[model samples]
Target: MTTRRLTLRQPVMDDAERIALYLNNFAVAGNLARVPYPYHLADARAWLRTWRPDKPAGETGFAIDLGGEGFIGQVGYHLDARGETVIGYWLAQPFWNRGIMSEAVAAAINWYFRVTAAPKIRSGVFHFNKASLAIQNKLGFIETGAGNLLCLARGEQVRHIDTELERSVWAERQDA
Candidate 1:
């Protein structure tokens, strides 16, 4: 899927270098639940090898490619252990505060809702990640709860604020 400033495409081997370059930064990896800090090219390669377009809905990902830049980040969703499909994303630190992630996430969510009958897309952020949480709020997500989540990069559980966006709400926002 294409946005005005991005091309959301399936990840490939060639993207490993860029992915690692961005994710290796502690600032980028610290907020994510799964990514380990000091992320390596090998880790990116292994992750890329797992991408499959045909995966069940809510279990797939897209490589976020900027217009001039190549792979800069990722936006996608996954089914949690509790059987909820929660959206997650991370952009290169250099691209922060530019509304790039907000746009990419909005487009990805639209595509996700289009392909599945899921009622809502769930998401959240670490308590201190106000920027990320703001992006979620901008896209119509609302706080649902709070708890602690394991951040692999941090190697510890951190306070988390849960959020959710319903399809109807997104549809209304799109029409606006």
Candidate 2:
């Protein structure tokens, strides 16, 4: 899916270097629970190869393009057993606080709900990550509960802060 400020496209093998740059940054990785710091080119290639497009079982990734500068960040969703779609995203430090990630996420959420038959979309932001929480709230997500143990690839435990947005609520927000 494409937006006025960003374009979402499938990640290519050549994008490994750029992906590695932002995914490995401590500043970026510190906010995200899944990606490991010092992310390498090999990890990017592995992720690209493993990410299946045809049978996307609720989990899908996109490269966020900021005009012609190439991939600036990534966003995607993972489906849970209860049919809720959980959204995740991160932006390069250079692109921080410019509303780029918010645009990318809003686009992704719209696409996810329109394409899939899910009843709701969910997202978790660490308590310290006020920027992300603000973006999610702006997109109509409401706080649902408290934190949980969100696991990371680097064997670190992240506090899973709360947020949820039902389809009905989202529809109402959009119509408003």
Candidate 3:
């Protein structure tokens, strides 16, 4: 998906170096619940291996690019046993607060709702990560509940806010 300032494409092994370079930063890893602290090249390589570009949908990840600058972040969804899609994303610290993520996420969500048959999209963010929460809210997600998750960067469990965007709500947003 191509936006005015960003492009979302399937991730490949060739993007590992850049992915590692950005994810290695604590600021980038800290907000994400799954990314390990001191993210390594090996981790990037392992993640890229999980990419299935040909898959029609479900749990597919994208590498976000900044026009000509190349990979700057990652976004995707995780499909659970019950067929709920949990959206997730992370951007390099250098690109923070630039509207890049907003654009990238909007594009990803639009594509997901367009192609996937899931009833709703689910997501959760650490309570302290206001920026992420705001992004999800701006995209029309509503608070569902709260819970705790093991944050790899913090190396402990942290309070989190769960949110979801049902297909009906998403359809309304699109119509508006």
TM-score of each: 0.97, 0.91, 0.95
lDDT of 1 at 58: 84
Candidate 3, 145-168: lDDT as tens digits: 998888998899999999998888
**Tens-digit lDDT string for candidate 1 (1-176):** 99889999888899999999999999999999999988999999999899887887689888999888888999988998989999999999998988999999999998999988999999999999999999999999999999999999999999999999999999999999
- Give Cα distance to truth, residue 137, candidate 1, Å: 0.6
Q: Pick the candidate with the highest lDDT.
A: 1
Better of 1 and 2 by lDDT: 1
- Of the two candidates 1 and 3, the one with more favorable TM-score, higher being better, is 1
Clashing pairs in 1: none
C-alpha positional error of residue 28 in candidate 3 after TM-score superposition, expressed in Å:
1.1
* The candidate that achieves the highest TM-score relative to the unseen native structure: 1
RMSD of 3: 1.3
lDDT (C-alpha, whole model) for all candidates: 0.93, 0.81, 0.88
- The deviation in Å at residue 3 for candidate 1 is 1.0
Candidate 3 clash figure, as a count: 0
